[model samples]
Target: MSVLVFAEAINNKYKKSSLEVVNYGAKLASSQGSNVIVLTNASADAAAELGKYGAQKVLNFESDSLHDNKMLSQIISDVANSHNADTVILSDNSKGKSLAGRIAIKLDAAAVSSATTLPNLEDGFVVQKSLFSGKAIGHYQMKASKKVITVAGNSIGLEEMGQPVAAEAFDASAYNATVEMVETKRVEGTVPLPEAELVVSAGRGMKGPENWGIIEDLAKTLGATTACSRPVADTGWRPHHEHVGQTGIAIKPNLYIAIGISGAIQHLAGVNHSKTIVVINKDPEAPFFKAADYGIVADLFDVVPRLTEALQKFKAS
Candidate 1:
C-alpha cells in the first residue's frame, strides 16, 4: 500500500507533532515494506530535514493562500492520488481532524482520529484509540482498503535515520482561499503545549499571576512546559492558550504535574489522557487527588522550591 504523510508547517517551522506523525507513518510504511512520502509547506531546506525522520521524498506546497481547510484538503488529496497513496497519515490536532473528513470523502477512505497505536495488519487493519475521554481503549478495524489516520501527539517517539532527501515543489499558488486569514497572532511560550511531553500546569490556587514564579521555576528546572487551568486564564493570570480544560486545549502529555489545581471535571476532560499525573494540592479533597497517580497534600510553595532544588542538584551531579 502506498503511504503518504503530511507534515504541516507553521511560521516556516515544523512542530514536534508533525515529526511524530511522520515517524508513525514511516513505521507503518516499513511494516508494509514501503517508505514515507512527506508533504509540507516549510522551506525546501526545512522540508528536506524530514528525511532524517524516514521521509524518503518530500513534496513542498508553496501557497500562501491555503487558509481554507477545504482548499488544503483538496490539495492533499490530489497529492495522495498522484502518488497512489492508499493510506494517508495526519497529526491528531484540530486542523488535521477537520481536514480528515474532507480528505476521506475525496478519497473514499475510512478516517480515524487520535489513534494511539499503529495498525495491526495481521488481523486486517486494526488500530487502537482512546475512547470516552481516555477512560477506555478502543480497538477498531478499518474495513475500507484505503484509510486516513491521525496519530495522537507524543504517542510515537521520533526516530532519526539520516538520509539525503530530494524535494519537489507542488504548485498550488492559483488556488483561491474561501476563508481568508487577515492576521495571525501566536501566543509566545517556552514550548508548544500540545506537543509537550512533560507539562507543569497550575490553577487559581497559585493565588495570582505573581505567584506563578514557583510554577515556572519548577517547570524550567524540569525542562517541562507550563500550562494553567481555565479559571486562571479567565482571571487574566495566564494566557488562554495555556488553559487546558473542556473549553480549552486538550493535551495528553506523558507526565502531567498539576499544581494548585482543584481538578474540576471540565479540567480533567482535557488532561485525563496523560500517562501519569502528579497533583500537588494542599487540600486533601481537591478532587484532583482521585485521578492523580501521585498526590502530595502539601502547600505548593513549600514543595515546589524543594522539588526544583532537588532536581537542580540531581542534574548537576
Candidate 2:
C-alpha cells in the first residue's frame, strides 16, 4: 500500500499548507514502509519539486477545471485504487476539506478532518485532532481498510531535502465536468495570510483607518501579511478577507503581532495557535495580554513606528 497526498497549488506554486501536508504524508509513509505519491493540478515542472519533501512519484493533472470536488474525488479514487493507497492525506484548506468527504465516500474510507497530529499507525489508524476551536484534543481510530486524513493547516512542519523527482502526467480526458470556468479575482503583491510565517493584525483600538500607515510600514519592513479583527472588517476599515476570528479565517503563523486589538475570545480562537503572539495595546488589562508571549502596554502610534524603524535597520544590515 502507498500513501497518497493531494497537493494544491496556486499561481504555479504549491501552497504552504499543501507542502506541509506532503511532508506529513511523507513521514507517515516512512513509518508505514510505503512510498509517498503527490497528486497535484500543477504543471509537471512544479510537481517535480515534491521530491525534495519525500514524494516518490508526482502525478500532474494539468487541467484547471479539475478543481471541482466531485470530479477531483473520482479522479483521486481512481489514482488511489491504482496505487492501492491505504492512507490518503489532504490539507485542511477550503478545497481539501470539501473534497475529503467526497473522496472518502468514493473510496469507502473513514475520513478525519482538521487532524492536528499524524496518525499512530502501529496501534491502528488512530489520529489526534483539535476540537472546540483548539480548546480540546480528540483521538479517533479509523476502522475502514482505507483512511482519509485532512491535516490542519500550518500544523505540520515542512522538510525539504534539496532534490527533485520527475512527474508523470495523469490522463483525465474521459472525465466530464459540469462546471465552467469563471472570472477569478485575487489579492496581489502581499503574501497570502494562510501561508505567511509572520502576520501583523490590527483592530478598532488603532483609532481609525486613516492612521494605518504605521501598520503598513511595520508589515512591509518585516515582510508580513496584514490582517484585521472581525469588527474592523465589518466596519470596512479593512477588507473582509483580512478578518480573523471565530467567524473569520483561522491562522497559525510562526509570529503573530497584534496592534490595538482587545483580544476578544472570537479573535483569540483564530490566532491562539500562533507560535509567538505579541500584543500591543493601550490597555494594560486587555484579555489579549494573557495569551501574548510578549506584550507592550503603550500607544501603537508611538510604538509601531519605532519598531518599524528598528526592523528596517536590521533588514538593511
Candidate 3:
C-alpha cells in the first residue's frame, strides 16, 4: 500500500517536475492510508529537503551510476520489493520513461506514462493521461499487484505539508551496472527552461541574431528563461538548447511571452502547457494571437523595447 516516489535532483536540487511528482505521490499515499517514500541519487543529507513535499522517508543512493538507467531501475525495483510498495511514481521525463518500463518488467507491474491526473482509487486503479500530444485525455485502469506511473510535467500542484525528515542510506552497489561513468558537463547560472516559472521566447520574425538584445533584455527584466522557435534555432539565431517546438524542447512555464513569433502548430505544441501566453506581433492575423491570453498587434521592434522598459521601471519602483 506504500507509494515510492523517484526524486530526481538536477544541479544539486530537486527539479520542479520531480517535486510535483513527490507531492502527487504523497496525496496518493494519503488516499491509500499509507506512507510516501522518496528515492534519490542525491546525498543522504540533501534528501531531507524532500520531506517538506510530503515524503515520510527519503532513501538516498550514493552512486556514480546515476546516469545508468538500467542500474537505476534495478535499484528502484529492489527498493519497491523491500518495502512491498504497491505503487511507484516518477516524473514523465526522459530518464523516468526509460527506467519505468524496465522497473515494471522487473517487478511484474503495470506501467503508465504521461499521466496528467491522479488515479481514482475508489473504483479500480484508474489513471488519466494525455494522449496524442496532449490533444486528448485517456483514462486507463491498471489491474496489477504493483503499478508504475510517470506523471506529466506541470499537471499537478505542489504543497509542503511535513517537516524535514532525515534521509536514510540505500546500498545499490550489489546491482551490477551495464554502463560506465563518463565525464559530466554541468550547465550553470541560467534558469533551466523546463523548470522556469516565466519564459520569454522569439522566432524568425525577430529578423536576425544581432537583434536578440531586446529579447535578452526582456527575459532579464522578467527573470525568465529565453527560448526560441524551431526556425530561429535552425537559423542559429539562438542555440539549439533554447529551441521550443515539437522537434525541440517542451516547456510548461507559468508565464510565456512570445515576440515576433507566428506560433506554428509545432511550436505551440511545446509551449501550449504554459499557464498564461502573451504574444506580440506586427501581423494582426498571426496564428499566435489565437492562442495567446494577451495579444498586441504591433511591431515587435517598437513593442519589445517599450515592454522591457516598462518592466524594468515597475521593478525599480
Candidate 4:
C-alpha cells in the first residue's frame, strides 16, 4: 500500500508543482498508514526538504536524459517496481503527461490524469476530475492492481508535518542518450507564471503594446506575475511565454485578474481552474464576465491606473 511520488526537479530546483504532488502523495499515504517516498534529481539538501511535507524518504537519480521521456519513464517504472508501490503520483503538467503513459505501460498499470481529488479507496479507488473546461465534474474508478495518477496543479495545499531527512542515491540506467553541446534559451521573469499565486493578465482590448505599462504597474504593485491572452501574444504585444490559453501555457493561480481580455473557451480551458477570477472589461457583454467572481465593466485605461494607485496606497498604509 506504499505510495511513490515522482516530482521532477528542473534547473536544480523543485518547482511549486513538484512540491504540490509531493504534498498530495503524502496525504494519500498518511491516510493508509503508509510512508511517502519521493523520486527526484534534486540536490540532497533540496531533496531532503520533501521530508517536511511528510515524505519519509527520497530516491535521488541524476541523468542528462531528464528531458528524454522514455528514459525518465523507465527509471521511474523501475524504481516503483522495486519498491512494490501500489500507487504512483505525479503532476498533470506537460512533463508528467509525457512520462505517465510510458510508465504505466511498463508497469501494466492504469493511468489517470488531471485528478482534482485524492483517490478514494472507500469507493473502489475513485478520483474526481473536471470535464469540459471545468463545466462538469467526473469521478473515475481505477480498477487495476497498480495505479498511476497525474494530479492537477494547485488542487491541494502544501503542509509541513515532519522533520527533514537526507536523500538516498538511486542507481538506474535503463536508457541514456549521447548528445553534443547545444545552446539553451530561457524566458526570464520575476515570477514563474505557472506557479504564481497571483496573476495580472490583459488581452487585445489593451489596444497596443504601449498601454502595457498599467498592467505591469498593477502586477508589480500586487507582486503578481503578468500574463496575456493569445491574440495579444500573436500580435507581438507580449512575449509568447506570457500568454495563457489552450495554445499557450496553462496556469492555476490563486487570484487571476484579466483586464481587457475577452474570454474565449480556448483561454478558459487554461485558467478555469484558478481559485478566483476577476475580469475588467469595458463591454458589459464580454464573455469573461460570466466566469469572473468579480467583474468590472469599465474602460481598462481608466480603471487599471486607479486600481494600481489604490493598491499602492493600501500597501503604504
Candidate 5:
C-alpha cells in the first residue's frame, strides 16, 4: 500500500515543517517499498515541489471551504480510503494535530503524535516518539488497517531525492463535511517562530516589558521572531504568544538566541531542537551554558546594545 502525507501550507506556500514531514514520510515509504503521495488543500503549485522530496504523486484538493478542520479531516479521510493507504503522515503543527486527531477518530486508525522518527519496516512498523518533555523516547506500533502519525517539527531534515515530478489531481467531494470559515485572524510579523530561520528570545532577565524594545530590535536586525520564557509571560512582561517553554510553543528554528534565561529543564525541552543556541546571561554558572553553543557572561543591557551595534557594523561592512 502507498503512504500518504497530508502537507500543510499557508498562502499556497508549503511550510518548512511540512517539507520535513514529507522527507520523513518519503523515507518511510521507500523503506516499505511503497509509493509516496503528498496531498495539499491549496490550489497553488505545491505539487511541483513534492517530487524533489521523493513524492511520487501529489494530490491537490482545491477548495476554500476545505480550510476548516472539520472539512479538511473529511477530505483526508476520503483520500486515505481511496488509496487504501497503509500509513498517513502529518507534521506536528497545530493544524496537523487537530486534523490528524479527527481523521484518526473517523478512520479508527492507530494514532501516534509527536513522532521523532519513521517507523521501522522490519519491526512491524513501529514509530518512535518523545515523551516526558523529551526525557524519553517511546516506540509504538499500529495494529489497525491504517496508521496515522504526526511528525515532530525539525526532527528530520529534508533532502532532494530527485527532480520535480508531475502530480495528478484528486477529487474528494463525496467525503466533504459541513463547515464554515467565517473569519481568520492573521498575525503580522516578519516570520512565524516555527517557520523562522532565526529566533531571538528574552526571559525574566529583561526586567520588564518596557525593556523588550532591545530584544525586538535585535530580532528585527536578524530578521528573527521574538520568544520568551514562561516566567516572562506569567509575570505579564510579555504576551502568551511570545512564550516558549514546556507550557508554551515548541520551536525548532535554525538559530535560537535566548537572553537572561536560566535555561530550566522545561524551557530547554521546548527549544532543544534548535540548530544553534546562543545564551546571554550574567550568571556564568547558569545551567543554560551547558546547552548553549555560545554563552556570554555579562549584563544583558550592556551586551545587547554592543552586540546589536557590532552586528550592524558587520552588516554594513
Candidate 6:
C-alpha cells in the first residue's frame, strides 16, 4: 500500500505547512516500504517541488472548480480509490482540515486531525494528536479500510530527500456541487495567523484602543500580523479578529512578540507553539517572563517606540 499526500499550493509554490505534511508522509511511506505520492490541484509545474520532500511521484490536477471543497472532495476520493492508498495525509490548515473531513466521509475512512507526530506503524497505525487546546495528547488508530490524517503546522521539519521529480497530470470527473464561487472579499493587511512566520501581539497592558497604533506600527515594520489577548477584545481595545487566546485564534508563528501582556494561561494556550517568544511588560513579576525566550521589564510606552525604531533601523540595514 502506498501513501498519498495532498500538497497545498498557492501562487504556484507549495505552502510551508504542506511541506511539513509531506515530510511526515515520506517517513510513514518509508516505514511501510511503499512509495509516497504528492497530489496538487494546480498544474504539473506546481507539483514539481514535491520531490524535495521525498515524493516519488507528483499528481497534478488542473481545474478551477477544484477550489470548491465539495468538488475537490470528489477528485481526492477518485485518486484514493484508484491507488487504494492505505493512508492519505494533508496539512492541518483550515482548508486541509475541511478537505480531510469531507474526504473521510466520502471514502468511509477513519480520520484524525491536528496530528502532531507520525503514527506507530507497528501493530496498528496509532496516531498522536493534541487535544484540549494542546493541554492533552490523544492516541488513536484507524480501524477502517483507509486512514486519513492531517499534520499539525510547525510540528515537523521538511528535509530534501532527493532531486526534483517529474510530475504527471491526472484527470478526474468533476462533481456538480451546488456551492458556487462568488466575489471574494479579501481583507487588506490581515495575514492569517496560522500561516504567519512572525507575529506581533498586544494585550490589555496597552490600556486603550488609541494606543494600539504603536503595536500596529511595529507589526507593519516587521511584516508581521497583529494579535491581541482576550481582554483587548473584551475591553474594545481591538476587534475580535485580532484576539489570540483560548477563546480566539491559536497560532504557531516562528516568532511571537507579546507587548504589555501578563501571560495568562488562556493566552499561553493559544501561542504556546511559537518557536520563540518575546515578552515586554512593566511588571517585573509578570508571569509571561517565565515562558519568554526574551523579556524586557519596562513600560510599553517607553519600550514600544524604541523597539519600533530599532526594528526600522534593522530593516534599513
Mind sharing the TM-score for model 2?
0.96
Give per-model TM-scores: 0.90, 0.96, 0.95, 0.93, 0.91, 0.90
Against the reference, the lDDT scores of all candidates come to 0.88, 0.88, 0.88, 0.86, 0.83, 0.85
Consecutive 10-residue window with the lowest summed lDDT within model 2:
61-70
Cα lDDT of model 3 by residue, 1-317, tens digit: 69999989864577778889889999999988998989988887778988989999999876534678987888888888899898999888888999899989998998899788889987889999866554667899999989999998888787888889999998776888788777877568888887788999999888999999999999999999999998888888799999987788888889999998998888988888899999999999999999899999999999999999999899999
Which residue pairs collide, candidate 2? none
At residue 140, candidate 5 shows an lDDT of: 90
Candidate 1, residue 234: how far the Cα is off, in Å: 4.1
For residues 116-223, write the lDDT of model 4, one tens digit per residue: 998887978899988876778988988899989999888887777788888998876545754333655556767788778999999999999999999999999999
Between prediction 5 and prediction 6, which has the larger TM-score? 5
Worst ten-residue run, lDDT, model 3? 129-138
- Give per-residue CA lDDT, model 6, range 212-293, as digits (tens): 8998899999999988999888888788888897889998899999998899989998888799999999999999998899
lDDT of 2 by residue, 130-198 (tens): 777777788998899999999987676777943789999998878877666586677789977877889
Better of 1 and 2 by TM-score: 2
Q: Order of all candidates by lDDT, from best down to worst?
A: 2, 3, 1, 4, 6, 5
TM-score for candidate 6 = 0.90
The CA lDDT at 165 in model 2 is 91
Whichever of 4 and 5 has more lDDT, that candidate is 4
Location of the lowest summed lDDT over 10 successive residues in candidate 4: 177-186
Which residue pairs come into collision in candidate 5? none
Model 5 score (lDDT): 0.83
Listed per model in order, the count of residue pairs whose N, CA or C atoms clash below 3 Å is 0, 0, 0, 0, 0, 0
Q: Which residue pairs collide in model 1, if any? A: none
